[model samples]
Target: MTPKRLHLILLAFATTSWVRADLATNLVAYWDFEGTADNHSSASGGAAYHGTLVGNAAVTGGTALAGTGSLVLDGDGDYLDVATIVDVNQAWTASAWYRPDLAPAGTARMMVFETSGNNSFAISFGLRESGNPASTNHQTVVDTTPTNDLFGNRDIADTLTAETWNHVALAFTPATATVAGSVVTYINGLVSQTLVIPAGSTLIIPDSGFHVGTYRNADGRWFDGSIDEVAIWNRTLSRNDVTELYERGAASLGLTADLAAAGKAFVSVESSDPALGETFGTGLYDLNESVLIEAVPKDGSLFTGWSAPFGAEPDFFNLTVTASVTLTAGFAQDTADPDADGLTNYQEIVLYFTDPDLADTDSDQISDGDEVLESLTNPLVSQLNAVNWIAANLGGGTEPGDIVLTRDSGTNTLSFKLKIDSSETLQSWGPLLPAATSSSGVAAGLIAVSFPPPWVDKGFFRVVGEAP
Candidate 1:
C-alpha cells in the first residue's frame, strides 16, 4: 500500500483592508526630510523645494513622522519654497508634524496656501497672539473672506501648545448651495474645529507658491519650529481618513515589502506595549521594538534567505525594530536525510524540533522509523481546518509527547481532551492548556486553526488522527 502524503506551504497575505487606510493616491507632494538640504526629496516627483532657505534653517535627524529626519526652520526668515506656484483654490488638505519652538509674540502666519491676490480663501495655522512671540500656546488659524464675517476665522477653542509635536491637518472646500462643512481642522486625529466657507466668495488658486515654516508673501511671519512629514493633497480628506493618517503615519499607505516567496511565509507581531510599536504581518514591520518573527516554512522545507537588516536566521530570528521596514524571506524544501529515518530536514524543523542527525531524537527506545513510518504518527501535513476532520495530526513541540485523535471526514463537529500541564498518562489528564479549551477555531476549514498574532512566540501543540 502507498503511504499518505502531506505538504506544508504557509504564506503571508495583505488583503484589501490594507489599502483603504492610506489616502496618498491624490497627494500632490510629500516632504520627509530624510537626507539633503533643499530640493532633495522626491516623494512627490522631484525638487520638493523651489524657493530659498533663509538663515540657519537646516535638515536635522531624529524625531520625524515618517523617516528618521526633519527640517528645522530657525524663525529667522528660514523656510522652504515648496511649490513655485501655489494653485489650490478648492478641495485641498495641508498636513504636517509641527513642533513649535517659540510662541508667537504677535499674530504669526505659521504656514499657509493663500492666493497672492486674495488672502481670505486660504488654509493655515498659527499662534493667535498680536505681538512678538508671546504665550507658548497657539490656535488653529484660518480665513475664508467670503464666509468668516469678512475676516479670518481662527479657532479660539483649539489652542496649540508650543514645544510639542502636534499632527495638524487642515482641509478646505468652497461652500456649496447646500449645507455642508466647508473648512475642517484635525489635530492628532481629532477634529479641532470647522469653519463655513461662504458660497459667495470667489475660490482663488494662489499664483505664487505654498510656503512651509512660513506664509506665502515675504511679509509672512517666519515660523520657528521643526517640521516633518509635510504632505499636500489635491482633495480634502474625510475625518476618518485624517484619523488614519495620524494613526498609521506613512504606513497609512500600504506597507511596501521586498518579500521573496509570495505564499510560503508569514510574519506575526505581538505588541505588549503599543505605545512603542503595533505593526503586524510578514515582511511588514512598522513598529518600534525588539521582535522575534518566526519564519515558519512548509513541511520538509526551510527558509532560504531572510535578507533584511532586522535579522537573518531561519525559522527563528531577532530584530531591533525601528521605523517602517522592507523584508523578505525565501523558502525551499530539504530532502537530505542523514538520519535515514525517511523524515526530511524540512519536516524536522517545522513539524517539530528533532535531531536531523539522529533517527531516535527522544531516544525513547524507539527509532523514528517505528514511531512514524510504522505507527503512522507525526506525519508532516498541511494545516487542515476544523471542517476536514474532527481531529488530525498536529505539528507540535517535544517533551511529554502529544496523543493523536480524529474522526471521519464526513463529521463537521468534533471535540478533544487535554491533559493538565504535561501528563504523560491519560489517567491524570484534566483541566486544559490554559482555559477550558486550550483554543477554539470558528472558521471554515484550515483557516480556523490559526493562532492569534500575540501567540507567535513559542509553545507546544498536539497531533490529531483517526481512531484505529
Candidate 2:
C-alpha cells in the first residue's frame, strides 16, 4: 500500500532559584577616587565620610588601578582627612589598591586612625622600607587598650613590585575569653601573615577621624603614590571575599588580557532549567570563583553542547572566571526523536500531535509510535476508555464511499467478515459476494472499509461472521 493507503480517507483529529551574593555586605566606607571623590558607601548604608583633599592630594585621571581615576599623594605634605569614624573594638577589615612611585619608606603611612586630639594613634598601617625596594615589609600598630598596644610587620617583599598596582587587606577577629584576638593580612588575594593579639587585650580604637595618604595629625609620613578603591568593613572578610575583591579589581584593570591572549578565556555556560528549557548554575559569581555549570534541555529540545572556546566540554562542567567572557550553551531544536520511538519530534509534535519527550503519550501500555505506525490507533486516547463498535456509510448511490468500522473497548482481539449482495429490486437479492474491502483500523476504537468502484442499482451489506 502507498503511504497514502495508510493515510486512509477516514480522518479523525483532536487538539536560580539561583541568586547572586552581594559583595558589599558590611561595607562601611568606600573611596573609589573617581570624580570629586565622595564616599562610595551607599551600597552598605554607611556614613558619607567624605574626604577633604589637602596639599596636592588630588584625584588624578588615567592613572587608576581599576577605575577612571585615583587619589595621588605627592609624599611631601599631601593627605586626605577622610571624616571616617568607626567602632574598631569589634571585627573589621580594610583594603586598598595602591601603585607607589617609589619603594616603601620607613615612615610612609598609607592609612591611620587616631583619637580626636591625636594624643596617640589607634591604628596605623603602612610600608617599611628595608633599604631594598624589592624587600618591603607591611606594618600595623594597634592600640588594644589605653595601657596596651601592639606593633608588628609582615614581609611582603616577594609581592612588592614598585611602580605597579598591588592589593592589600587586613581583617581582624576580636579575641574571646579563651582565645586571643587575631589579625590576618592578605596581599593580592593571598594570606600574607596572621598576628595574634595578647589574650587580655581588646581593640580600643574610639570614634576618631581616619586619614589617608599620611599619618594622623598631618605628620610628615605621607604616602607617595596613587591609591584607588579603598574600603573598610565592620565585619571580617573571608578568604573568598578577599580573593573576589582582588580579582574583580584586577579584572577591571584588564590583567587577564594576557591570559586571554594566550588563547584562554573565562567560560560560563548558560542554559534554562529543563522545565523552562534553561541551564543550571545560577547566581552571582566572583571573577576568580570556579563554578559548575550544567546544561538542561527544556521540553521539545536537546542540549547539544557548549559553544566555542569550550571545546569538547560536557553538558555538565566546571569553569573558573578569571576574565570577562560570555559563553553560550548549544541546543538542538525539537526536531529529534530523543525517545527513540518510531516518530520524529516533528511528526509527534506537528503531525501526530503527541508528546515527543514521552515514548507513550497515553498510559495504555502502548507507545505512541507503535500506536500510530502499527495499530493505526490514536495515541492520546487510552484504549481502556470504553468505546462501542460502530459503522457509518459516508456516501451513497453510484458515488465513491467509505464504510467506517469502529473497534470495541479494551482490545483489538476480535475479527469480522463482511459480505454484500446486489439486486435490481429490493424483493430479491443477488448471490452474496465479499464486501468491497475488509475492515482496517482507522484510529483508537475506529476502522474503515473503502468501496473499490462500480455500483449496481441497489446493494446490501452485512457482517457475516466474527472470530474472537
Candidate 3:
C-alpha cells in the first residue's frame, strides 16, 4: 500500500557522507525523505529512481537526522525497495542514521538492504551472537557478495542504545598490488572495528537491487525503527572524513575546510568579525565565506612566515573559506645572529648590551668584528683582548701601568670597560664581564686610575658583578 507522505525537505548534498557540491560527483543514491518516499539524489541525465513505500510506513517529522522528516519502519513488513543505482560495483561508502525502537535480538533484524542471491551485497545491523570473540552485542554487518564463498560477511562489532539515534558508516576499499583491501566500520565517525581482508583474496562489490528497513527476498525481518540520510558514495572515505560528519551535523557538513597547523607557531582565526584566539587546531570551517587566519609566534621567536591560503600572497592573512587546508607557520629564535656579529642578538636587543648587526657598533676606529675575527681579541673590554681577563689586565690601566682592576679593591669582584656612542640614541654598551679572579671573595677596587684617558668620543664606564 502506498502510504501518504508528509512534510520533507530535500537534502541532496547534506548526506553526512561528504560536504558540498564537489562531493556529489560519486553519490550513487541518497534517501533523504524530502516530502515523499522518492530518492532525493540526482543521477546521470535527470533520471532518478524513487523508492516504493511498501506496507504501513509513512513519512513523519521530528525524526530526521537531517532535513525535515524521515521514513518510519513499523517492524511489520514496512520497507523501501530501491533499484540498482550503480552498475559494476567497486569501492563504495555508505552512511546512515537509524533510530531503533527496541533491544535487537538474535534475529538478524535488518535495518537496511541486501540481496539474497549471487552478485548481491548485504547491509544490516543485528545483535549478533554466534562467532563473536568478545561476546559483544549489536553488530554492524556487511557481506560483500551473496555468492557465499571463502570470503563474506565482515561483522564489525558495535553496541546501540535502544530508542536512541545512531550514526553508522560502512566502507570497503579494493585491494591493490601493494596494499590489501579492508572493511572499516564507524559509529559516530569513530572506527568501531576494522576487519582486514587476507592477501590474494579479491573482494568484489556486487551490483544489485537493495532495500531499506527489511531483509531482501524474505517476507519478514522488518526494521522496527526509522532511517534517514541514507547515502552512498562510490569511493572510500578516510577517518577524518567521517569525523567531519560526526563533529558537524549534516546541515553544516558540506564543503568545509579541515584546518590544521604544525611546528613552532599557532593560528588565530575568525569569521563574521568574531575574535578567535591564536592557537593551533584540527578544526573544520564552512566554505564560500571569508575566514581570518593569522600566524602567531612564541616567546623569543618571530613569525617566520605563512603559506598562501586561497592563492593569495604570503603577506595576505585573510583567507576565503573554500577548501580543506592546513596552514603551517614557521618561527625563528633570538639566538640566530643573522649578521655574524660578535654579540648575540639577544644581548643586543634584549639586554642592550651590544650591537647585533654591527661588529663595530661603537665605531671607536676598531671594529669588534676586526678585534674578534682579525686580531682574535675579546670585544668585551676596551682593548685587553685576553680570554682570561682577571690575570692579564689585573693592573693594566692607561697610566703606563696603572692598575685597571685590583684584587679586593672595592669590596667586590670589579670589572670596568669603556662604552662607545654614549649619546644614548646611538650608544652600544660593553660585553659580558669575565669570570671573577679569587674564589675567596675578592674585594677589588680600582684606585682612581690617574684621570680617565683623554678620549675624542664620550666614554662611559660601569661596575658590574659583586663577588660572593
Candidate 4:
C-alpha cells in the first residue's frame, strides 16, 4: 500500500501602474526607531544626526506600522534633542507615522525648530485639541521674526482616530523679501490645507536646536504617543511623492529608489488539508513589506508544520517580501478512526490502499481492517470466492479463503493461480508444490482450492503469490 498524498499549488500575482522618478532625492534625515533612537540618513557627506532620549522616552517593540519598534513618549517631559539637521529659510518636506495615545489638552507638538535665544521665534508642527488661539486641529507655525509669525488656517478639526497610526507630511517654501511662498500640510499623504506666506517677511534660520515630541522651549507640550519612520527632505515633495510614501510606507523609500528596484514580491501559500481552512498572507506585496502568514485548522485537524523553504522554522510567521517564494503548511487529522472502522485512519491510508472515509472500500460486507488483519486478504478487492463459499457451505467449507484475482471470466490462458505455502509452528515455511507445478485450475473468477484433511490438520497454509 502506498501513502495517500495531497498537494496544493497557488500562484500569487500583482501589478501597479503608478510611475515614480526619485523618492529619496532630497532625504536629509530619517529615523526608523527599530530598537534604537538614531538617524538612518546619509545627508551632509553621510554624517550622523543622533538624538538623546529625554525623560520617559523609550523604544518599544511591535508598535511600528512598518518596522519592529517605535519611539514611545510620555506627555510629561519626553523628547528627542537632535541638534540641527535642516537649514531654515529653504524649501523642506517632513513626514512621519504618528499615533497619539491621548488627546492633547492644548497642543501636542510632533516636531519643533528654534534658534539659540530665550526671546526668539520657533517653528512648530503639532496638533491642537482645543481651539485656544485657533480652531484647526492640525497646525504648522512658521516664525519669521521676533514680532511676526504665521499661523495655520483656523478650520475644522482634522478628525484623527485615537491610537491609530496615520501618515502626516508638511512641505514648506520660505518667502523672500519681495516674493511670497507657501506651506502645505498632508494627512495620510493627501493635502489637507495650504497657507500662503506673505511677502516682505524676513526668513529666519532655525539652525540652533531641533526636537521631536515637544515644543522648542519644552513648556509642557510633549507629544504623548508613538512616532515611527520620521524623515525629512531638503526640497518640497510633490503630491505623488507623499502618496507613494503613504502607500508603500517609509522603509520602501530607498528600496524603490534603487536602480535595480525589484517592483513586487509574491508569496504563494498552500495547505496539506485544504478542507480544514484557508491560509492568509498569500498574495503580491511591496518588495519591502513585512507580511504575516498563517493557517486556521478546523476543530479536529492539527497543524503539523510548514513544508520546504520555511521548513527550518516551521512556526515562524512573519516574512519580509524581499523576493518571490512559495510556502506550504501541513496539517493532520487528529482522529484515529474517522470512519468508525477498527483500523486507524493512518493504517487504512498508508498501510492499505483503502479509503479512510469508507470502512468497506470494496463494498463487501467485511470491513477493511478485518480483511487485512484477520482474513489476510486485499482490502481494496472484494473477497468474492470466500464470501460466496461462506454463504453457501455455512460451517463445513474447507476452501482456502484469501486468494483474489481480476481478469476476463473463464479465461483459461491467464497462466496464474494462488501459490500456497505451509508452515508448521509458524516458523519454517516452504511452497506446498514444486516451483514448476502451480496450483491447478488457474482460471478467472470464483475458483476455490482445498487441501486434504490430513495436510490441513498438519500445518497452517498461506497464499504467497500468483504464479504460473
Candidate number achieving the greatest TM-score relative to the actual structure: 2
Go through the candidates in order and give the clash count of each: 21, 7, 13, 0
TM-score of each: 0.46, 0.49, 0.48, 0.47
Rank ordering of all candidates by TM-score, starting from the highest: 2, 3, 4, 1
lDDT of 4 at 452: 64
Worst 10 residues of 2 by lDDT: 11-20
Model 2, range 157-268, lDDT digits (tens) per residue?
A: 4545678888878888888768788878788888877877767677665455677777667766667778888788889987656766786677663222233444333333
Candidate 3: Cα lDDT at 55: 82
How well is each residue in 1-468 modelled by candidate 3, as lDDT tens digits? Answer: 223222222233223222222334466777666566554453321345577788877767536665567878777788777666554236777777777766432134455555333434545544343122134354555554323443434455465555666777777776555676676878876888776645444533444566677655647766767777667777786565565555544442321212322111112221211121133333455455555555554333455454333224342356555555445454454676655655456555544455677655544333555555554444555543332344354446555534554444232234434321123333543222224443445323212233565643433333443322
Supply the global lDDT for candidate 4.
0.62
Candidate 1: tens digits of C-alpha lDDT, residues 1-468: 223222221112232221223355567776767676564444554565444455666777535555566777766677776554334555778787777665532234555223333343355565544233334334555544444534354544555666667787888776665544466778877787776665565444455566676665645566767777777777888665575566545342211111222211113332222332233343333344456755555556545554433334655666654433334455566878887776777666546567677776654333455456554444333223422332434323355556433333332223344433434575675332434322354322222256677754432354443422
RMSD of each: 20.7, 22.8, 19.1, 24.6
Model 2, TM vs. native: 0.49
TM-score of 4: 0.47
Mind sharing the TM-score for model 3? Answer: 0.48
Better of 1 and 2 by TM-score: 2
